[model samples]
Target: MLRRTVLLTFAGAALGGSLWQGAAHASEGRSPYGPLQPPDDVGLALPEGFTGRLVARSGHRVAGLAWHAAPDGGACFPDGDGWIYVSNSEIPLLGGASAIRFAHDGTVRDAYRILSGTNLNCAGGATPWRTWLSCEEAYRGRVFECDPYGSRPARPRLAMGRFKHEAAACDPDREVVYMTEDEKDGCFYRFRPTDWGDLTEGTLEVLCHGMVWKEVPSPAALVKATRHQVDDARHFNGGEGCHYADGVCYFTTKGDNRVWAYDAKASTLEPIYDADSPLSGVDNITGTASGELFVAEDGGNMEINVITPQRVAAPFLRLHGHSRSEITGPAFSPDGTRLYFSSQRGRRGILTDGHTFEVTGPFTI
Candidate 1:
């Protein structure tokens, strides 16, 4: 078994649970999991006692509607005793978000579209209000707030910003939404809502030196790029994924292969993992109730690496085939016993062959 002791643990109640795991959680890093077994029937290599199951496949009928291709960022939402896993489709023009209703016992109850008619719907964050922020990863893209239950119609949150958006992380304590841009010279941003839980209007600011905030004169960037609108905005090398737990916000920079930790309370930003670290090609990210971070690789060894609370990072699982594919969404179930993610390009290394998988095992809390 691999384990470590964290030097710092957040206060308050963590109960140690999951984003559909209830997404980012605060808990001690104490995992009692062992090494990977062999590659399973699904071509996935997981740890001992952990089993993988196919939850959805691209271009296939899940419930009735054909599943979307190129599944990207996703989160689990609690639905009664069961839960719903919402995923983004990365296909241009047809890009949107979909949801899979799961029974308490992990059975697929239904599958349907939540958001549609968007472009390049990539990674996004889960809000405390049970809404999924589906981001569009294209030029002048926007963030769409979709209901996981598929009841309410999805709305475009134009005030958030209009750039090549990749992902978002909601900081409820501070009532801010942290976002990442997927450009070579992208800038990290945060939107402060005019009212708590409201996304229609807000002040969009970019993160500057010393973790300070600098107001972005424009969000739509019709005249100038949003990253250039702020004079002192800190530049990141292609930011991809963002997640928040306790008071710390963790995000990934794909170009630099770095995982950043932004201490909201302390007002500081630092890299927790870098190019020399164990993981590479870090893309989509998520955390467990035990406070362990799960980072999916975009091009490396096709592995999902785990970062312990003590900051020890290592690979937890790897896919055997599909070398051309990159791992996207890495989320957990509400009970924290099961994990969900997708291979953007599965067996044939194409968008239409994407696969969303579920892995169930005994995870430490």
Candidate 2:
């Protein structure tokens, strides 16, 4: 497995002291939100002055729609007087996506299903055209383009390639979509649409070492053909979350427990953070308008790792008392004032259902 390979490959150097010591966080005085506070009564340990409020929990009904289970990936879009936050369900058989309309004051007014009849709908990326691309994380998985306002029915975007999918990020300037795979031997992909902002059809290419581009003959079988069968390309261990900011594509590798940044223009890749140094099990990632990266830890003593532009890593928020679960989502509002995320499996033994929350406070400007 790629996860096994990555562990055998980088386990020895995961704490390669000197190489990453320089990347450690600066003193608290340099922190943008200050030191993190203890877990609040709501089970979230956030930064000072920050508070988290539960928006929806599993089985809750909103706008005549019973909240979906296992809310995984999500994105927020501007709406009338507020915005809509769309979340993907990781349930394999009943995989789908949901949308919750949040008022400007941060309250969820109504929630409804936007996409249905999918499989393992995982993390996805929001597009410049104000649509959400909900990704399926199954073998031969697909990306579905969804409209949050319910103006258009969700459509499957076949050209985006298939694999054990994770999340995607769009380069608004280039109109290219960057995606990640959740397999240990997964490859990072880029989809160039024939028409800008359109994902119905495109060419898919995998990023190889030295930033070289290699076209996947049949992206639908990429996992079987190149990743497992022939298996010669350099692959990331369990690619999870991805976000594009300032022309840079940043994604996380869960098995390797690392975050990497790819500069498409320069075709260069660089590591930003390592596991256990401050965070581990890196999953869904999002970039703040300020360019800082927020990463949700998957299934551990769950905590959100904040990586500054300078590469410093700090504990942004921790999910206290949650067991057998991890944090998902982690998207910011259009204005970047409010942060939204979900506890995939909810608190251990106490709340078995999934739940979503919104965090508001003095976010860095």
Model 2 per-residue lDDT tens digits across residues 313-352: 7778888877788899999988788889999888653223
Worst 10 residues of 1 by lDDT: 13-22
lDDT of 2 at 197: 76
Deviating ranges (above 4 Å) for candidate 2 = 1-31, 222-232, 349-352
Q: What is the TM-score of each candidate against the true structure?
A: 0.91, 0.89
Global lDDT scores for all candidate models = 0.85, 0.78
Regions of candidate 1 where Cα sits further than 4 Å from its true position? 1-32
**What is the lDDT for 255 in model 1?**
91
Alpha-carbon shift of residue 136 in model 2 (angstroms): 0.8
